[model samples]
Target: MIRGQCLITNKDDQYNDPDVAVILGSDKNPTCESQSVLMAPKIKLSSGYDMPILGFGTYNLNGYQCLTAIHSAVESGYRHFDTAFNHENERQIGEALRTQIQMGNVSRENIFLTTKLWNIHHDPRDVRRICEHQLNLLGFEYIDLYLMQFPVGYRHMCDEILTPINDISVLTTDVDYVDTWRAMEELVKLGLVRSIGLSNFNMEQIQRIIQCSSSKPVVNQIEIWPGFMQKDLVDYCRYNGIVVTAFAPLGQPNREKHTPIYFFSEGMKRLVKKYKRSAAQIVLRYLVDYGVIPIPKAGNPLHIKENLKIFDFKLEEIDIRALRGIKSKERLVQYENIKNHKFYPFERED
Candidate 1:
């Protein structure tokens, strides 16, 4: 959002930046090309906007690791970064950008940045203020995309919409989703955010908001994987032209029990052997082929290196069909507290 004119202060422009270490010495690295980027798809979202198919995930990223990961991801050709207010690493994200600028690795123009407005900041009046606070914390001019973390609104408030029964998180029918969306729209119009999106919202909530918004949201960031494939929601969003951004692409490891690597079923195992790839790569590529951008989480450089090596071999149709048939519909990060929220749409009818 650096308006007046775009300036490059980093390495050289891989995609329009003037800075990203361009060595026109005519020395091509055969190894780099052989690994991937052969048929790498440059995905464009609904609004004709493009970002790298793979993005960097910073969910539990904190402290020194967050800073280092941000730098490493960039040097490795990751231009899209996803962070949230709850992540508590905005300052580090900002610090890494400054460090890379000094290192001549990346520039402001070459990155597509996204951050979320926490559920606590969903108030119609306070949304703008909260977004401004995020900008200040991230030390950026303007955010590339900002998302309302979920369908969070104050509960039991008696206003023009409806009268209150009691003080609680479960809202009444008078909850004003349109009012909240209008406020978010104002953020985009004011140039505080380039685009607006949603995360953890249900079909009913998104349908209601999209009906009234001045701008249709271009992205729907949510949790989608082989285990927890919310097919109904996926169909609805894709039909409306909302690009899906998946979080927790790999099933989260049971850190406490450290017993979670069961995602690799027999079918996946055979496919991995046939493809000569890791389970993580298979999982990531499966989602990518399904038209959802997968943000695989990893802090270790070697793991991160493996995570992004997804574009090399395409997932065959047989592999995709087999993966689809094996869906367990399991959710790893279901926050049960949300069941008390007014818009708790995760309730299973079955």
Candidate 2:
């Protein structure tokens, strides 16, 4: 028998009981699962706030695409949702959550909902507006966790023209990142948001934030796949009591145009057959083995169900080592630039 204490999510009840755990949400039917696939651990936030490990990802989804995927995610037993105003799918996401709750699929309290403040909203004042708008549009009374999308931001000050005499230096004057986090921290204090976090930050940046802020970041969500996995970062966060959330947990959709998945490559694919699992399963299992929470997105009910099938099996130590050895460390989605924005904040060796 698995020795750890286990608890199930109770949507009708607040997680006042420290013994209770939150289940992660992904694509799957909450009511059905193979007997072998044990139910997920109690889901809750890193700050000891309620959160589900198997949450839904809303990046790059829109219109009916966003709606249907969210519908399937809810059906698939997902109670945690990760979305943002930039995604522009908040209305659909809100509607889906409300509809499912009304139909008795889940209670509002059972869900761990997260939304982000885009880079453009870096001003402390703008952060409040953006977060409040997200809450209103998504129709959630309060957001569980709110993250600052990135550390970089700028105002309307024009510095494109460089003149020796004028000496226009690129100094930050808009909403400083530190200011934004303070605002997010205020949200937590006000109970408008349960916890606060960072997304797309490197080690140096995270440390900087921790050094200057009154509120510590509880979670750090970033891209993680075998190809681009950041093991050191994940381990560091765990040691520091910060939960790491893996986005683009599978090879990102940008790489869907490529050949075999990183997990399905000759080395790992053979392991999949050995383990009797799919390539996606191998990748997800790899993440879980590392103690990182993965948010993989898919709309197909079958795919959603397949993802939830993970709890049934455990990867062997040797197999886990072998998967770790397959290292291309490829980042499938690094921003070159968005709109007219010209900046890159990732460590890449090309």
Error of 2 at 186 (Å): 1.3
Model 2, position 294, has a per-residue lDDT of 85
lDDT of 2 by residue, 1-350 (tens): 11122235545333445545544332224433322223344444557775655567887777887787777776666666898766778889998888877765566776778888776667787677667778888888799888887776645332221111224433334456777888888887777888899888877777778899876788899888776778788877777777888898887634455543554467765877898998788778778767777888876778876776676577888888877776575576675342123233576546
Off by over 4 Å in 1: 1-41, 154-175, 254-262, 348-350
Where is model 2 poorest over a 10-residue stretch in terms of lDDT?
157-166
For all predicted structures, in order, the TM-scores are: 0.80, 0.81
Q: Candidate 1's residue-wise lDDT over 255-296, tens digit each?
A: 466433446456767888999998888889888778788887
Off by over 4 Å in 2: 1-39, 43-46, 154-174, 253-261, 338-344, 348-350
Displacement of the residue 348 alpha carbon in candidate 2, Å: 6.1
